[model samples]
Target: MYSRLSLSWITSSWAIGLLLVFPVIAIIYQGLQPAGDLFQHLMDTVMWDYIRNTVLLILGVGVLSFAMAIPAAWFMAMCDIPGRKYLQWALMLPLAMPAYIVAGIYTELLDFAGPVQSVLRDLLGWQTARDYWFPNIRSLGGAIVIIASVLFPYLYLLARTSFLEQSVTLMQSAQLLGKTPLQAFWRISLPLARPAIAVGLSLIAMETLADFATVNFFAVNTLTRAVFDTWQGYGSLHAAAKISTLMLVVVVLLLALERFSRRKQKVFQKNMGQESARLLQMKPWQQWLAALFCWSLVVLGFLFPFSMLIYFAAQYFTDSWTTEFIEFSLNTFFIAGVVAVLACLIAILVGLFRRLHVQRGSDIPARLSSMGYAVPGTVLAIGILIPFGWLDHSLNDLIEHFGGKGPGLLFSGTMLALIAGYLVRFTAIAVGAVESSINKIPPSLDMVSRTLGHSPVKMVRKVHIPLISKGCFTAILLVFIESMKELPAALILRPFNFETLATYVYQFVSDEMIEQGALAAIVIILVGLVPLIILSRSIEQH
Candidate 1:
């Protein structure tokens, strides 16, 4: 009976994994098929530009994020600075600010006719455009800066933890050897934390590659935008799928680099207690400088944009408040809620299987399902559309042959497609959350339950579920929040006339009228803050 149950568990896990991963496999298989002209035309025209822009965007974001994050991480982790307690986590606030929203706000302020340059002109006594050489904020360089500003937090979080985990003896030894603080950091600390830094860099790079709205707003022709334009403008799924494949190539490379970095992770990261490491005490002036540097990142990355959002929301309260906004808010909530529940179920299924099975290849289903998280949203959408679109046509054809009215687009043109895309993209978050929680459960509990005549199913229902309930809830919240913020997949898979708050907010942002959507944008930002709150509390407790 246990063997039978084991077979059932493996079969169910595999089935779900294959279904979720099917779109990716389908897209890749379809991408490889010969596309005679339009694909060739795409290759001849904008392909190189897309590749170049994507590479540059990644490279630029990597460099800029590293510069901002490493110093801040070191200050927060090693030096005794004002507000270190809060500043360490406050640095993470920018992660809540969507890249496109930041791009829009900065563009408005820095553009030629906007307040920043206008103020510069007024102060510098320059009258005309030819008289001054202000930077162009709508260019590729601007996109890099804006995206990096928000994304640097990923590096800060990881690097700070890595620094905190280092043994204090090494630092003291370097100091005793007459090395200056800066020199010690450069020679000893930086090399030890290289793996964490590399891992963080890979995350920043992947996110930069995944960004679509920011680049689209800037008119930068990266692979994401290329996929969108080719499919929407040119009416060629074949071309879009091929472009998506190119993006997958980049994502794969980044993932490979991230995994390689992690291979050296255990060697460098010993679990030294944070409090055991003595912090450096800086001079008053140096302390002030450090505080300014840290707070400036908080201000630019989060506080400023968030404050601007609040101001716009208040000023345009009447214009932004509408029946449409409420309806779309409900729409966003409904879809996000459904995806959250479904994703949590998928997570529990696969994660528990991995915990129990423990045999060779047991991890594959979870890994395969998690792969979608690494995929760019645009690529995932194209992958989903290819197979689901075919199934929709086939279903309609079958209905027609049976002399019955067909359910038009039952799969493709409804909430089904959108939900499927969310599951494919975000179930990974749920799985990771659930698996982490499960690992914390004592193995003796599972053994005791089985000895007491509990079946695997009964044991999980009565014991594991209650223990991991908090994790389950956390997983739901994360998936829901991510689904709410998701744009690229929603843009592609949403039913006609459907609008989530993200897409709704994006419409106004794209039209250069962020004030109109400020209220909606605020909702997204507030929702993104939930997990951050949880994270801070967890770190404090630890």
Candidate 2:
């Protein structure tokens, strides 16, 4: 028998769920309504270009992500390659880097005036751009490469873990049938890992779809950029909402695929397949080649970009160390801090309600709270903007009815909209962490707490809070880091003159002067590394 649920607790939980989900609902509602000529204008004009580019981007990135990840993943798990120890986790470093930052780094290096081309020009005695043909690093192809370079870790980590967990006997049986190691991997290991790979691919697609700065930087207009331009460029909420709804369709499809893939995930015994004998012995040259491939991804994706950032920052520390940097750093920390604490508290309240209350649909709030995770940030910003914009208008009008100076655009114009957007998008991360920790506590502890004459609140305070404290801290940190790095929502919803490291870096990047903002960019990258470090340590511990 579960503890009796209090009306207040239940009502509060349900209300939180509704509030978190309201933005997405508002987007749908606004999108369904008829907009003026601008909507159709978009439909007839650049809409197909956006669609074609977005589709091509997805296909190119998906195919490339698989190619980049699958072999590295296989090598990590199954081959006796040199540097396997460092390379396995080092490959994940790129995942922490924002795609735009990496794009900017490569753009600088590969551009005609940058060192690579300049050196080539000097060595070959070519005078100018017309003299020799070099691939442009600011095209759709460049965007695909930049995105896949960072995003492939999603696939790599999942595929490698899936490969590790397969039954050893399956591989042995394939080998006994005279299958080469490569043939065995293709026929057996890869097939069984499809569910995990599917889930990973879907995540890659979502991240790729949500990407804005890289595509925008490279002048490749995709749907995400379309949503930003449709709203900010033309100031049409309904038109933006319509575009957002289109993106939501893609999001929904990806999510449904992920859910189905999760259900189809296979279970197996003999999960510990990392034995030395089971590992394939590659020749010395092959080992070097395999290790070099993994290392190249690390260098291109993380090390090279990061080292270049360091060089730029060192060269331009005086320029980057400015009053603006301090202001935006404080702004970022303040906003991320507030969002983290609030998200942590909300996750605790909602998670505990589901765990202890035992009411019908108690888990609904938890489900609803995380739906925003699937929502792209640009769409979510619009979702938040619509309802809150209405609220702001209504409130200001009501105040002005009595001849009072309206707290003008209070909700929508202030940090409220920004905070709301962050909460909706990132609270799910907190909720998942907290819920996982809550699950580890045995049911008997709950019964004991209840039987000691403690009420629900008291029971949680004395028991659940302490046990889940680490998870709670992790939730806060994760939300804080995500809030810090979040670009799209922050870009759309930030108050006038407010900037975070991401937006600040983007400004300099947009102008082809990333060196000026390199210090701030380094700060973002370093902060982003915290969670990755924690994860790496945790993986090593296990």
Candidate 3:
């Protein structure tokens, strides 16, 4: 019986691991098959621009995100500022808005013909472009700001968690040695939280690298944009594959840096029973300033874009609210639901396999499976097309050989491919959630269950399932939200005439008709708030 269960665990782990890893393998293989003159043409023409723009965008977004996240995190976690309680969760609201949607809104508002600059021109009596200088919304700098505003929450969440979980004794000791609160924070708290901050920055960096819609919308030539253009614009899948491989290499480097930052860093908690550090009282002016800073981020990052969306939805209700829109919404929900359930199941299988098997390499499968979260959606879409396309071709050939008409694209262009891409992309969230929940359960329960003659499956069903139910819900909710908001993969992989809310919104945004899709964008944002609320509550409890 034990042998059978062991075999089940091993088989399931390897199967899921390979499924997760297959895209990366496919891209690498596609990248290696020589592109001949296509590679040379890219190198001689736009490759330099792609590399330069990608680096600048990553660096710009990283710096700005840290600037926005660190102080807000510090104030919310440690300072007794005015509105701190409200601001704590409000800071996380931006995570609900996709950067591209924000970009679309702001571009309209700040454009030359849009309200902001138009009003400025009317007031100044300016005739034309020669009257005064104004910043371009559709530029590299604008893309950086838009992406950073929506993404800084990644840093804030992690940094706040680190601050909240730090050993109170360390700060108290620093105070005893005559360090002021600010000095102690700078010297002790900030340094100790470096690993957490590094992890957060790495996430932001990967996201910046992965971004396609915002950059493409702005006409910036980043690597992600290059990949899309190379394949769709130039009709060169080989060149696209090469670019995807290059992007993967960059992601791997970022992951390595994150690991290095975490290396040799012992997270000392003093004791599990130790209380968190007390929040320091701020002067009245300091309180007002902190409140202003944090609230400003909340307004700019979430409130402004969300309000604009609502206003547009209201103004265009007749045009935007249609049967087609309803169908799109249903499609989004259907795909998200399917992906969420499958991700949860895979996460459970991998999580349980690692838990039950104490072998030396038992954890490798979980690690491999989660690596896809770091990969860009566009890259993953391209990666998936390779092997699945081949499968479709092989099936069609077999069907023709058997004297039956070929069923076109059995896997590649259908919902099956989209679901597979989503699972590869988001199963990490579920795996992490499940593993954390499982770790909280004592091993003695498992031993006792086994002694009672319960099979491993039955033991999990009767005990682990009920115990980790909340984690399971969280996993499902998070993956669902992510899947709903995902654009690039859905863009590439959806079948003919199929439209998810994200893809639908992207089409409107691309056509500069954002108002038409405003209602759908709002729906996506509202759905995303579920996971943000969950995260906020979880951090507060910690």
Candidate 4:
């Protein structure tokens, strides 16, 4: 009976894995069969520019995020500075603010007629563009800042975890050698944290490469934008597929680099017998400076943009409030909730399979399923449309052959396609969370349950489910928030006359009227805080 159950589990896991991977395979296949001369035309005209801009943007964002995250992580994890407690979690709030929204707000604020420059012009007695030489907020540099501000939390979270987990004995040993605190950190702590930092950098790099909205809004032509333009602007799906394939190649390379970095990671087991290293107390001036640094990041990244959104929401409350707005909010919640539940179920299945069937190839299915998280939303949307559109057409033809009217777009333009995209993109988050929680359960529990004649399903239900309930909740909340904020996939796959909050907000942002969608944006941000709060509390417990 257990053998049959295990076989069924492996078969189902493999089936889901293949379904998730099909879009990528379809995209590559389509890219190989491009429309006449379209691939060549893109290569000759704009491919190099896309490549150059994308590399530059990735490098710029990676460097800036590192600079901001590393020091902040050190200060939070190692220094007894003012506001350290509040600043630790407050720094993560930026993850809720989408970079495109930030770009839109700052663009309006810093534009010539907007508040910042208007004040500057009035104070400096300047009249025109040539008066005082303010920087353009719609340039490559601007996109870098916008993206890095929100994304630095990726690095900060990991680096701080690394810092906190370091063996206290090592740090004390360095200090006992008469090394200054700065010297100890520079020579010992930073080197030990490199693996974690590398993971953070790789995450930042993948996100930078995958970003479409912020760079597109700023008019920086990265490969993602090229994919959008090739498909929508030029009406060439084949060309878009080819560009998406190239982008996938970049993602694969980044993944490889990340794996390589982790190959040498050192695990530090805490010697609970020994006292942990003490946090350094800062002088008053240093404390004030540290407080300012952390508060500046929080204010600039989340608070300032959020305040602007609130002000705009209040100003346009009556105009923006409507039955349609409520309907769209419901639509967003309904779809996100459905997708979250589905993703959580799939993640649990995959996690159980990995734990129960620890064979040579057992890990492959989970890895393949998780790969979707690295693919950009734009790429996944286009990839999904190809195979799903073909399936719809094929089914329609089959129906017509039966002397009946064709069923119209059962999969292509419906919520089915949107849910598929969301599952492919976000199931990885759920899988990671669930698997981490599962690893904490003792194998002895499973053996004891089995000895009592419990089936595998019964054991999972009676043992694992109760044990990992918190992780399951985390997985659901994370996927739900992500699906809510997801813009590119919703924009492309949503049925006609349908609007999720993300797509609705993008429409206004694209038209340079974010004020109209500020309320919805606030809702998205508020929902995003649920997982972050959970994460902060978990870290505190650690």
Full candidate order by lDDT, most accurate first? 2, 1, 3, 4
Task: Point to the candidate with the largest lDDT.
Answer: 2
Candidates in order have lDDT scores of 0.90, 0.91, 0.89, 0.88
TM-score, every prediction? 0.97, 0.97, 0.95, 0.94
**Collision pairs in model 4:** none
| lDDT string, candidate 4, 1-542, tens digits | 13335677889999998898888888999878835587798888889999999999999999999989988998988888888879999999999899999988999999778999999888889999986788898999999999999999999999988888777777678778998778988997788888888889999999898889899888999999998888778887788898999999999898898889778676765632322245877789988998898889898899999999999999999978999899999999999999889988888988888787757677777887887898999999998999988999999999899988888988977999999999999999999989999999998998888789998889889899999898899899899999999988887788889999988888788889999989988998898888889888988776
Q: Estimate the overall C-alpha local distance difference test score of candidate 1.
A: 0.90
Q: How well does candidate 3 score on lDDT at residue 396? A: 93
Weakest ten-residue segment in model 2 by summed lDDT: 265-274
CA shift at 397, candidate 1, in angstroms?
1.6
lDDT at residue 380 of model 2 (Cα atoms): 98
Query: What does candidate 3's lDDT look like per residue over 1-542, in tens digits?
Result: 13246576789788888889899899999998977688779889989999999999999999999999999998987888888878989999998899989999999999888988889888989878778999998999999999999999999998987887776777778889999888987998899889989999999999999899999999999999988888778777678889999999999999999999889888767531333346877799988998999999999999999999999999999999999999999999999999999899888888888887776777888998998898999999888888898999999999999999999999997889999999999999999988999989998898888889998889889989999998999899889999999998888889889999999999999889999999999999999898778777876676
Which stretches in model 3 have alpha-carbon errors above 4 Å?
A: 1-9, 167-180, 267-277
| Model 1 residue pairs with clashes | none
Q: Write the number of the candidate with greater lDDT, choosing between 1 and 2.
A: 2
lDDT, candidate 2, residue 313? Answer: 96
> Which segments of model 4 are wrong by more than 4 Å?
1-3, 6-8, 176-178, 262-277, 358-360, 401-404
Better of 1 and 3 by lDDT: 1
